[model samples]
Target: MAARSALAILAALSLAIGGCASQEQPATQPSPGGSATSGTTIKEGLKIAFLPKQVNNPYFDTSDNKGGKPAVEEFKGAYSQTGPSEASPSAQVSYINTLSQQGTDVIVVSANDKDAICGALTEARQAGAKVVTYDSDTNPTCRDLFINQASAEGIAASQIKLISDAVGPDGGEIAILSATANATNQNAWIEMMKTELGKPEYAKLKLVTTVYGDDDDQKSFQEAQGLLASYPNLKGIISPTTVGVAAAARYLSGSEYKGKVQLTGLGTPNQMRAYVKDDTVKSFALWNPADLGYLAAYAGAALASGLITGKEGETFTAGKLGEYTVGKDGTVLLGDPFVFDKGNIDTFDF
Candidate 1:
């Protein structure tokens, strides 16, 4: 009966986690400010800069360079990417201030902390720059629009499903190796994961603990090591961040726990292919980071062009990806996450 219920949950999630359509879904909460407009010309040579959680990070590198940069080029805008080397709350504040002072037309950011960057973002807005937060969000009032990779509920359910499947029906102890504890997206998903775990179907699975790696490679590797040492009976691990999942995979791939413990979470194809091939990881999931950046760039362009305000019911077309609508609280859903394993991992390059 437990097995049946678990499979039922997976079946339902399989239906829910499919790709988001190019049309608008219904809005739940209304946006705080801004009025909608039909369309406008995207100004050429507009100065648009991306400030990621940190500079030189693989995930951000792809999102900003491969995704955001090309979109900026497509729109004929002046693009610049800059941020701190560390993923700290205040690390991005100074960069935000710098971009604002440069009189940038649009500032794209993936905030490290939800509130830490709000004041700076507000100031940027006051200086006539449109603020768009992508990947990770700040408070709703802080930005013009938020480009979310996937819905929080969808992500939470999918991660739980992956770990549950990897650990088998007779689930035992599990732990979460996540990015920084203060990460807005990470915390939102973690809370929903806990809610999912509370269901009777998952009673056999106990979440032993959650450890933060601060999104640092070495620190994530050490956190993975510590989880195993601290909990000998840990049956699986769910790492919701790309850096955390990749670092944990590296640690587990070389250790005695290679095949003994299951690992799954958000990871790029290039990073998790080896682990999937070697069986260190059963499966994992993530949306295309490049596409995320691409969409963000278009959204920023729309805001700067007055094509759409951050208001709900507003729609804009992203190049090559199609149209999307602004959802409640100034949010736009990119799409659902795609899971990767040995079968399909080879087909993906990034």
Candidate 2:
């Protein structure tokens, strides 16, 4: 029954995204110096690479090192990974430039800023590289396809439910811990969360403030500490980014308010395990990071192989993850977020 409902949710999201934003850079163009037609496919021996928001961030590390690299290897495609040490749009532009110059067949990225990297991405597309945006997205015109983990409405509602359940019916003051101010996915989810709060049942729950951690571990830790000191009456916190959630968890676990203030948001099992065991967090949520990357690699492969041209209703197979079809706006659905608590936290390792 649970499995059935999850599939239904995914189906709904897949249908809804057609009307949403997901512009592929441009349709596939024939390889240079070759006779061209709509049927012409790019050459084999595809070289694929991924550039995430940051290199050392644990969340991206799991996606790239543990998940993405393995999938690329399974398909026998040449694969490489690169990104900035700290996440910023300008910091990623140079990496994009290098990948484009290297003539990588496909470049997968989790955009730091939607528009900041557009010029570089556009240049890469012009250089014959297919762009796939995952985790976060670049502008629709800047990528070939976007691998969305889950629907923003679904993730936001789940976060609201977790905090509401932990804080109880009477409700209380709450705040949000988020990623960079301009993070496309982060901002979209936050907006949905605010809309969720407008429901009558949540009238008593007051949103005290929202803070940014820039997806930095130390900065997020400090931001969590500050929220505690500033909002003495704060009842709960919702952190929608993996980095922010884990860092906030680190701060709340050892603090005096450990059990007093509830924490819930999107996080990986490895990062939130200790907090769940210690009772600092009852529940948090996320999709499988490895699966997210695995699907993305397959999508990049499909584009580079000319199996699909980023058209709605085009289908392709991702090893182990089964088959996926391109939806409206060149969007592909990964899956829904799963909640992790002490009960199920022990079951997942990434």
Candidate 3:
């Protein structure tokens, strides 16, 4: 991981000196709210800012500090992260506005709401900031590209498989504990999970209900408690956000349902390690949050450097992670979700 991080930093730095910009909105740039023109060029010495759903989040912290910082440092791109402490669209808007006012080159974000931030993102793009969404995404027209941590189906399937394996093939009643209702990735994965549950192999795994934690720790804990109280027959849960899963683990760890109700979802190894050890959780899934940030930084650098336009069939290399081609709708799949269990959990630290 260290080597990979270093490699990312070096790669981004190497490209920092080569970009060129135009006097008018570059040929590749959209005329604000319009589709991007392919082959448009951007300038180098990119100034980058990361506005996550909120500040002080452990997941974002790992990704930005460990992953993004190194890459930005290498490229000599001036990097900063500032956002509202609470995950709200309004809060993010304020930060986005400030970054634009400060003339940031690329604005990397994890949007709280897809449409809510579009206005601010548009303003930033008009101000010449390349908008890149990672983790959670803004509406497609609102950003230049999205860095998806994993395929929605793959993530949904992994979560369901973990919970099903924990509870058994018979599949007792289960529920989804998700982030914000409008969170792009969360909503997409939940929908996919619902569709997957309708399949024949998952016939016995009944989905009783779904709940939202708003990605707040206290709220997620309370929501977990509510799920237990509201659905006594529920046998398993899937929390697809780091904050929600850890909070759910905290709520279940001390309760009588600790071992009785299975909990599995996307979580950082550090945050869920104790829960896994103490039997509050069986197994969970997630990509490396740090790598997600690293990838996003590289993608942003590529866009700012004009290495590849955010167009289908455009390919660029991400440090350590290797080459990735832009897919439809300007999306890049980061790969698969990794399962962490008691046996192998000890092998990972991030």
The residue pairs found clashing in candidate 1 are none
Query: How far off is residue 245 in model 2, in Å?
Result: 1.0
Residue clash pairs of candidate 3: 28-40
Per-model C-alpha lDDT, please? Answer: 0.85, 0.82, 0.81
Instruction: List the pairs of residues colliding in candidate 2.
Output: none
Sort all candidates by TM-score, best to worst. Answer: 1, 2, 3
- Which RMSD does model 2 reach against the true structure? 7.0
What stretches of model 1 exceed 4 Å from their correct place?
Answer: 1-39
Best by TM-score: 1
TM-score of 3: 0.87
> Per-residue lDDT tens digits of candidate 2, residues 1-350?
01225555444333222211122122233323222234533334678899999998878777776667766666667878998999887899999999999999999999988999999999999999999999898889899999988878888999998999999988999999999998999988999999999999899899989999999989999999999999999999999999999999899888899999999999988888999999999999988777678778878877887767787767766665556767778788887787778886776666
Per-candidate TM equals 0.90, 0.88, 0.87
lDDT of 3 by residue, 165-192 (tens): 8998767899999988888899999989
As a whole number from 0 to 100, the lDDT of residue 278 in candidate 3 is: 99
| lDDT leader | 1
Better of 1 and 2 by TM-score: 1
lDDT of 3: 0.81
Instruction: Kindly list the per-residue Cα lDDT of model 1 for residues 227-247, writing each as its tens digit.
Output: 999999999999999999999
The local lDDT score (0 to 100) that residue 52 gets in candidate 1 is 93
